[model samples]
Target: MIGQFPPIILASKSPRRQELLKLMGIDFTVVLKEVDESYPSGLNPTEIAVYIAEKKAKAFDESIRNEIVITADTIVSLDGQILGKPETADHAFEMLSALSGRRHDVITGVSLLKGHKLYSFYELSEVFFKPLSAEEINYYIAACQPMDKAGAYGIQEWIGMIAVEKIIGSYSNIVGLPTHRLYRELCRITAQ
Candidate 1:
């Protein structure tokens, strides 16, 4: 039986995350807060993602109680450099263009905060892209709002079908959350 607790809270504005949670039958609320994503320069991709996720969770006012809080941060890394959200259409174009005919890593950091207890984990997925044309990149950038997405692309979008040649890990990780890891972690939190 499900234990009686406050409704789970998701600290994100991503519709994909929200929908994915819904698909898992987890009831949650979208409570987004602005947090500075800047992290130490030396941290690896997973560390950076985890650090930012925890930072976002910590940003929530301390007044909240009981309910579990889930927060996440995702980053796309190529050759050890993190490719974050695009600053402009051209930036998105550049990111995608570079990714063409190459494989990149998408890392997502997930944090589950229940009261004072905090658990954090990260998942990385390798995404391969077929060599794409400049016009194709431009079309994707213009058609999809890449500014809000990491790696300047969305895995569930049209780009995923044509541009993504293969995925070596959890596809959901590229979407923002690793559902398999998240489900297990959330269950552990509930079991505790």
Candidate 2:
């Protein structure tokens, strides 16, 4: 499947995304570019994700040749409010506290740029968390240091192992990238 695609460039600094791409059996190089992830007002979670992803892809506009550049952004939204990465341990605790015994949406926006053509899409997953105690949340924060992840948590970490009660849609999406959807999209684009 990877052979069908052109040389791939992953324009992200996320280790999870890099690992996921490697696990998908796709050969790619990681290219980091600073991108402002802010979105305009009134955009929903899905739109924000796709917007940031495309914005990141656009950073490579001047450098891209024939290689396919992939970029993605993931966000966790509770109700209608977005919960981005925590700025401090206290903030992480607050975010986790709000997420306790609640359901939230984890949306990942992805973009693929090749030559002059660009495509963007998104995947959303519903995650339910069981009620978490203060001790549990504090412990997870101190031990895991979830300041780098959205929603103050990683679904593959200790918090997820103990707190996640149920999930609907793609698991890999919550981890950062939607591998199946990405693979299908790659196939579709490469076939064209």
Candidate 3:
């Protein structure tokens, strides 16, 4: 039987991530800390995501003990451009407009730290949006408050319910964390 893992510390403020972890039956504590999210200019989407997640993991002091510190970064990439959180409503609208009836990649990178050892991995989900109207976008944004979400939208929101026609990878990745892979990795780490 799978047993409980060591004490885990999640370094994220995302309600979705928290809920996902709880849904997975994993016991972990939230430990928020600010880390410089900026990355090098030449990095790809997965690289950028992993870099930031590892950076957040590194923010914890080296004195950390038995607890496993977890950090993650999610990025929405369309074409070759990275779409972060929307700065304003108009920005959200613009992002939604561009994404309408298009396909984009949502990548989430995760890092787990125990003492000085670190394990990092990334998951990519391709999302396909149905043709959406300006009114639909506006209404969804007003109802869901997606300004803080990457890609200006959340896959579990009303917009996702209506606009997301298909998904090619982990649904949890689009939600901010890749739960299945994370659970498997945790099992491996705990077994060690």
Candidate 4:
């Protein structure tokens, strides 16, 4: 699987994304390129995710050789509002409080860039959380330090273990990247 596709350059610093790519048995190089994640005001959840992903991919110019550049963005949308990474502990607590006993959508958009050509797509997963107490939210926030994660929580962390009630769609999407869809898309692109 590693050698099936052209060399891949993953343009992200996310450990979760790195782990997912490794789990897929794909050989790729990690290259971090910071890009503004701001999106148009009217874009929906999935669109915002894909837009940022493609924006990150475009950071690399046409000089790239045979390497395929991969970039991804994940966003948590609750009632059509995006819950981004919390900047402060208070904010994290607020995000967690809003998510209590509610179903939210987690969408991740991925972009694959080869030289000047680009491909992009997105995946969505619905996550339901059991009603959480203020104590539980604060405790989880203190323990997990979810400031770096969207929706102020990691689905693979302690909060997810006790708080997540159920999920529909790809679990990996909620984790960060949609590996199954990514693999299939990579296969399709490499086949050509």
Candidate 5:
């Protein structure tokens, strides 16, 4: 790990997050914990993301300490509404249709917990898509069942290869983790 504070623990079960951490060369262990991913009705997308990450961190066993525990949550925002992983193909299609040719935001929240200390932050990226035809959307949908992804799409997938026109922020944020900000934060936390 860059910081060398202690062995890191990942509080999420997301393979995307694990892959990101691995790419960053950060050694970490996994402790899958489920937390209610709810938020206050008025909270914005970034706030909701951070709150969910904190919730996941708190879900860990109380015996956890000393080691740094990293938890993260991601969501898509368009027209002031938050979009999460779809439960079905229909839901995924609906989400993609809503985002077709529109600019949306992807936000990822990270929470670092070490004993009594807790730190949380969020990063946002703006993604714009070209107007996608129904045939194109259907083709991509059939090729990649993105029901498990937010905004019913993955920026690293087939749809992204064609539909995504411009991205105004971190690419990793849309993929799920925001590794640059995460690296900096890890350095700061360990330097303390």
Candidate 6:
């Protein structure tokens, strides 16, 4: 399947995204370019994600040619507020505490750029967490060190194994990329 596509460049530093792309059988190279991730305040989670993803893609404008450049951003939203990567263990605990016994939306926005053409989309997944005790949260934090994950958790980590009660959409989206949607988009773009 990957043989049908053009040369690919994945513009992200995330190991999870890299692993997911590899698992999809898509051959690609990892390229990193620093881009400001901040977005306008009034935008919703989906918009914020897509905006950042497109911003990352634009950074490669000077170097792009026949290669399809892919970039993505994932954000966790609870009650309309975004919970970004936790900067500290204490912050992770706070984010996890607020997420305990609650449902949140994980939105991953993807952008594909080839030359001057750009395509962008977003996928949202609903994740529900069973009520977590302080002990459980503390243990997961100490064991997983979820400081680098959005909402202070990774759907594929120790916290997910014991805490995730249910999910209503793509599991891959919560992990930071929507594989099914991404695959479809890639097929569409590469066919053009």
- Model 6 stretches with alpha carbons more than 4 Å out: 1-3
Which pairs clash in the backbone of model 2?
none
Q: Supply the global lDDT for candidate 6.
A: 0.93
**Backbone clashes per model, in order?**
0, 0, 0, 0, 0, 0
lDDT of 6 by residue, 59-154 (tens): 998898899999999999999999999999999999999999999999999999987788999999999999999999999989988888889999
Candidate 1 lDDT over residue span 19-113, tens digit each? 98888778888888889989988899999999999999887648468788899999999999889888989888889988999999999999888
lDDT of 3 by residue, 1-192 (tens): 664889999999999999999998888899888788999999999999999999999998574799999899999999979999999999999999999999999999999998688999999999999999989999988898898898899989899899999999999999999999998998888788
RMSD of each: 1.5, 0.9, 0.9, 1.1, 1.4, 0.9
User: Each candidate's TM vs. the true structure?
Assistant: 0.95, 0.98, 0.97, 0.97, 0.95, 0.98
Tens digits of lDDT, candidate 4, 38-57: 88899998899999999999
Point out where model 1 deviates above 4 Å.
2-6
* Deviation from truth (RMSD, Å), model 4: 1.1
* Alpha carbon lDDT of each predicted model: 0.88, 0.94, 0.92, 0.92, 0.87, 0.93
Residue 160 CA displacement from its true place in model 4, Å? 0.8
Alpha carbon lDDT of residue 75, candidate 1? 94
Give model 3 RMSD, 1 decimal. 0.9
Candidate 6, residue 179: the lDDT equals 95
Reference-based lDDT, residue 136, model 3:
100
Which model is ahead, 2 or 4, in terms of TM-score?
2
lDDT-wise, the better of 2 and 6 is 2
On residues 2-116, what C-alpha lDDT tens digit does candidate 2 reach at each position? 4468999999888999999999888899989998887899998899999999999999988988899999999999998999999999999999999999999999999999887
| Candidate 6 global TM-score | 0.98
